[model samples]
Target: MTYTTRADFMSGLREALGRNNIPDARDILIDFDQHFDGGAAAGESEADVCAKLGDVDEIVKQYISETDGRFTEAQKETPVQETVITDNEPEKNMNTGDFAQTAKEASAPEIKNERSGPSAGGIVGVIFMDIFLFSWTLITLLSLIISLYAVTIAFAASGIAIFVGAIMIAAVGAAGFISTGFAPISLIFCGIMMCAFGGMLVIASIAATRGFINLIIAVINLNARRFTGHNVCRKIGRKYREERD
Candidate 1:
């Protein structure tokens, strides 16, 4: 359901029309556009559409052959003039150069070959995601989630250990105070600080856990929306192009 090759094919067709001096080039292009759109709506990929259209060079030759008579007649009626080529027309020259560059970039195969991950095969990364191979975005987010969970577990364990230690210290202090009718200020202070530190650790653990959970939920929702939006747009664009063509 991808239309990666459509624009390249259209560009090549346009150039072919120009080379042949076709008078109704725009109309012909529109028809081709419609044909591609119709094919796409029928669940064909851009590569399939292009294959159906056949070779670009062959199509160009066919157009030139079909309109040879009209081209010859037009050339006879058009006046021949001596055009002076000069370096003074830098702006026009620059415009022509820019147009050529733009066309070259647009028709480059890399346009269709770009992947969603570090390696080639964007669609493969999505459909065949594995532990070793997947989208970079997914890998990075998953790593972050794993690290966050690891931190959360460590914090929770530390908090529980500290809390237990604090309870033991407080119980000792209470027992000594009851047995001897006196408790050392240092022991009481130490117990209170340990309990406070343990409580803070527990709170930090909870916060980290909640944050990691929310992040995972957000990532799932975001990826889902992005995938759905892309598909919807692709469908609408295919239909719109078919209608316009």
Candidate 2:
């Protein structure tokens, strides 16, 4: 192609490269413009030059399409944009490439909890979860043992209270007017205390069950071939060799 035709083609090629920048375009341009003065030396007419070079768009496409199994930087780095629609609102949107770069960035999460979603039952739930997760097994194992000792003492004391209260009720005929009926009130209060203690006991039992289950699961994972990337053959051989030694 003539100098003018080659110049026009190269200008467009440069713009396309800026956006899609495939190496194939660079290679094609290299082969197509083998002239010493960069395709100008050919001195062919503009129309004839373009005709020989063929369709510029089709040539660019063909170059990009010749990818072998091996991946270049551009090919390997091409963004795979995936769309995710959660129940939460979409606060930000960008190309997949840019989003991934931001994810790997060494910074704290920009979205704060308050802005992310609605709050829970706040302090009440927090207290219950703390009781369920952190107490008994984690923070108060010894306290729980002490509480067991206290349970034995309380049971013996309450049984005596029950027997004495019954006898008093029969003798004094004053079950209805014992300390202006505060005896029943106090007993009701004791019942509530016992219920709270029972709830705590239940939580402790659940936490212990979960902890032992987790331990079992950990042991199972260690023995499994997939978790440690050891095959059954390797395990059998190791056992056999251990027995021999």
lDDT scores of the candidates, listed in order: 0.49, 0.41
User: RMSD of each candidate?
Assistant: 20.5, 24.6
- lDDT computed for candidate 1: 0.49
Best by TM-score: 1
Q: Which tens-of-lDDT digit does each residue in 4-46 have in candidate 2? A: 4555655454445434455433333434544313435666665
Q: Pick the candidate with the highest lDDT.
A: 1
Query: Clashes in each model (backbone N, CA, C under 3 Å)?
Result: 0, 1
Question: Candidate 1's error at 90, in angstroms?
Answer: 26
Residue 94 of model 2: what lDDT? 15
lDDT of 2 at 233: 21
Q: TM-score for all predictions? A: 0.30, 0.25
Candidate 1 structure quality by residue, lDDT tens digits, 1-245: 11348877876776666665665554556567777779979999889989878887787677767776656665534311111112122122222222222332333323323311233343333344333432464457557656765665665565556556656666776776534223444444555565566566557665644544443333332233334422111111122233222
- For model 2, where is the 10-residue window of minimal lDDT? 86-95
- Tell me the TM-score of model 1: 0.30
